[model samples]
Target: MKHFFIEELLPKAGGSVYRLTRMAARRALELSEGRPSLMRKPSSDKVTTIALEEIAEGRIVYNKEASSVSSKDSTSPRAVLMRGNLASSQEKASVS
Candidate 1:
């Protein structure tokens, strides 16, 4: 399997690790499902390696429309609290 440095691929993924992983993971999923690779010569047979290669080669990119939405500070206290509350509520509802 080929290994890639985060610094090398950051720009290709719009400089966001979140976006990079999102794009790579989706592409990897497609490849694992037997979708033909877009590369003329893929770097590796492993799905993840092929996905990163595609990303580095500009075949895959972060979602432009979602940039604004995903750029939000979802790690803020309020966001975490909201998620925690939602999860607890979901658990409570499911237990009944």
Candidate 2:
């Protein structure tokens, strides 16, 4: 497995470059004592779960997904509260 910093892969000059597989990069990062935050791809039948403890304690932060303001029929206050609660739970899990 090989992992290189983003700066190494993409330089200010910006030229074509080949890369290692995600799994390989992940292993390399792990060996280098670096944590990689991978982006989730949208797909059916695919679930993304993170063990908060897997990340360093006190590093968890919450960010809300964008909602349309003009969509009058969308987004209930209760749903927003639930999302906040979920974020809190994740943060607590990391702390524990």
Candidate 3:
């Protein structure tokens, strides 16, 4: 088994122990759900271990940006797609 110290992992996770723990937890959950690993010899690495290694190696980046999508941007691809679907549904309703 590979043993790692908290000191070694904190630097890779932007020096935040909370961030490191959060990332490792989420990644481990994904791994448990059969997500493919970013490491070699994945068969031998436990999910939590692989998660830690990925964070330590900088393979996973934290998304600091806001998650919400603004609908004010009508030209956005999501907006355009939604508009297209609405138009089609309205057309079908009129035809019926």
Candidate number with greatest lDDT = 1
State TM-scores per candidate: 0.62, 0.17, 0.58
Report RMSD for candidate 2.
Answer: 15.5
For each candidate in turn, give its C-alpha RMSD to the true structure in angstroms. 10.5, 15.5, 13.2
Segments of candidate 2 deviating more than 4 angstroms: 1-64, 67-72, 75-84
Worst 10 residues of 2 by lDDT: 51-60
Q: What is the C-alpha lDDT profile of model 2 across 5-83, one tens digit per residue?
A: 4453333112223211222232234424533322232122111122121111111212224311111213433112112
Per-residue lDDT tens digits for candidate 3, residues 2-95, read: 7779998887556778777766777777778776776666534688988777766666655334322112333443321111244678999999
Error of 3 at 3 (Å): 0.9
Off by over 4 Å in 1: 66-96
**Error at 1, model 3, angstroms:** 1.4
Candidate 1 at 4: error in angstroms? 1.3
lDDT of 1 by residue, 6-88 (tens): 99899876788976777677667767877777777886788899888877766665545444211123343221111124467
RMSD of 3: 13.2
Please, what is the whole-model Cα lDDT of each candidate in the order they appear?
0.64, 0.27, 0.61
